[model samples]
Target: MGPLTPDNYELVLGLICFFLIFGVLGKVLLPRIERLLAEREDVIVGGAARAEAAQAEAQRVYEEYRAELAAARQEAAQIRQTATEQGAAFLAEVRAEGQQQRDELVAAVKVQLAADRVIAEAELREDVVQLAVELASRIVGEPLGDLPRTRAVADEFFERADQAAGEVQGSGAHA
Candidate 1:
C-alpha cells in the first residue's frame, strides 16, 4: 500500500454482469411467470361469477314452485266447495220428492175412506128397508110381495130421513 487509491475496473465488470443476467431473466422467465399469474386471476373471477348466477337461478325456480303449489291448493278448495253445494242441492230435491209422495198417499187414503163410508151407508139403507117391509107384513097379517109397493115404502123412508136431518140442524142451532 504505497498509494491507497481504488480501482474502477472491477466495479465496472460487476455492474456489467448484473445487467446482463437481469435483462435475460426479464425477457424469458419473468414474462412466463406473469402470464401464468394473469391466467390464474381470470379463472378465479370467472368461477365466482358462475356461482352467483347459479344461486340466482335457484332462487327463481323456488319462487315459481311455491306459486304453483298455492294455485293447486286454491283449485282444490274450489272443487270442494262446488261438491258441497251439489250435495246440498241433491238432498233438497230428494226431500221435496219424498214430501210429494207423502201428500199423494194421504189423498189416496182419504178417497178410499170416503168410498168405504158410501158402501156402508148403502148396506144400512138396504137392511133398514127389509126390516120395515117385514114389520108391515106382520101388521097387515099378509105378505106384501109387489115390487111397486116396496119402492113406495123406500121412498117414504127417504122422506122421513130428510125430515130428521132438518130437525137435527134446528136443534144444533139452538145449542
Candidate 2:
C-alpha cells in the first residue's frame, strides 16, 4: 500500500474490524443500555404511582379526621344544650319553690294579723264596756250591782257599732 492510501488487504482488514466492533456495540451494549433505561422508567412510574396512592391515603385520613371532629363538636353542642336545659329547669324549680315559700309566709302573716286584730278589738270592747258601767254608776250616784245586765247591754252596743261600720263601708264602695 502507498503511504497515504491503503492497499487492498489493509482495506479489507479494516472493513472487517469495523463490522466486528459495530456488531458488538449494536448486539451487546445497545440491549444492556435499553434494559437499564427500561428498568429506570419502571422505577420512575412506580414511584409516581406510590406517590398518588400515598396522597389518596392522606386524603382519606383527612376526611375521616374531619368527620370525627364534626361528630365531636355535635356531641359537645348536645351536651351543652342538655346542660343548659337542665340548668333552666333547675332555676325554674328554685323560683317556684321560692314563690311557694313567699306565698306561705304571706298567708301566715295575714293569719297572724287577723288574730291580732280580733284580740285587740275584744280588749277594746271590754275596756269600753267597763268604762260605760263605771260612768253609769257615777252619774246615777249609785253602784250598778247587776253585772250580767251590764254585760248584755255592752254586747248590744258592740253589735250596733259593727253594723254601723259595715253600712259605712258599703256606702263608700258604692260612691
Candidate 3:
C-alpha cells in the first residue's frame, strides 16, 4: 500500500509546477489581461467624453441658428418699413400728378367754353339781324333783301346798347 504522506520527489514536483504556473500568470497572462482591461476602460471613458463634446457642439450650433433667425426677422421688419415708406411716397406722388392733370383739364375746359361762347354769340347776332330785317320788311310791305346794310345797322345799334348797359352797371356799383 502507498504511504499517506507524499514522497519528497512528488512534493518537489508539485511545488515546481505550482511556481511555474504562478510565474506564467503573474509575468505573462496577468499583465496581458490587465492591459486589455485598461484599454477597455479607456475606450468606454473616451466614448462618453466624445458624446458630451458632440452634445456641446450641437448646443452651440443651435444657439447660433437662433441668433441668425432673429437677425433675419429684424431685417425683414426693416425691409417692410422701407417698402412702406417708398410706397407711401409713390402714392403721394401719384395723387399730386392726378391733381395736376385735373387742374389742367379744368383749365382747358374753361378756355374751350370761352371760345364756344364767343362763337355762339356771333351766330345769335346773325340770326337776330336776319329776323329783324324780315320783320321790318313785312311791316313796310316790302322784301328787305339788303342783308349787308341790315347787318351793319344792327351792329351799330347793339354797340350803343352795350355802352348804355355798361354805364348803368358802373353807376350802380358806385352807388
Which one is best on TM-score? 3
- Mark the regions of model 2 whose C-alpha exceeds 4 Å error after superposition: 1-51, 135-146
Quote each prediction's TM-score.
Answer: 0.50, 0.62, 0.71
Q: How many collisions per candidate? A: 0, 0, 0
Instruction: List residue ranges in candidate 3 displaced over 4 A.
Output: 1-22, 145-149, 156-175
**RMSD to native for every prediction?**
7.4, 5.0, 4.5
lDDT of 1 by residue, 1-175 (tens): 2245435776688778988888888998899999998888877887788888988888999999999999999999999999999999999999999999999999999999999988998898888888887888889988764557797879787889979999999999999
Clashing pairs in 2: none
The number of the candidate with the highest lDDT is 2
lDDT string, candidate 3, 1-175, tens digits: 2788898899899999999999999999999999999999888998889889999999999999999999999999999999999999999999999999999999999999999998998898888888888899999988885756876799898899889999999999999
Residue pairs clashing in model 3 are none
lDDT of 2 at 107: 100
Error of 3 at 75 (Å): 0.8
How many angstroms is residue 32 displaced in model 2 relative to the true structure, after the best TM-score fit? Answer: 13
Task: Rank all candidate structures by their TM-score, best first, as comma-separated numbers.
Answer: 3, 2, 1
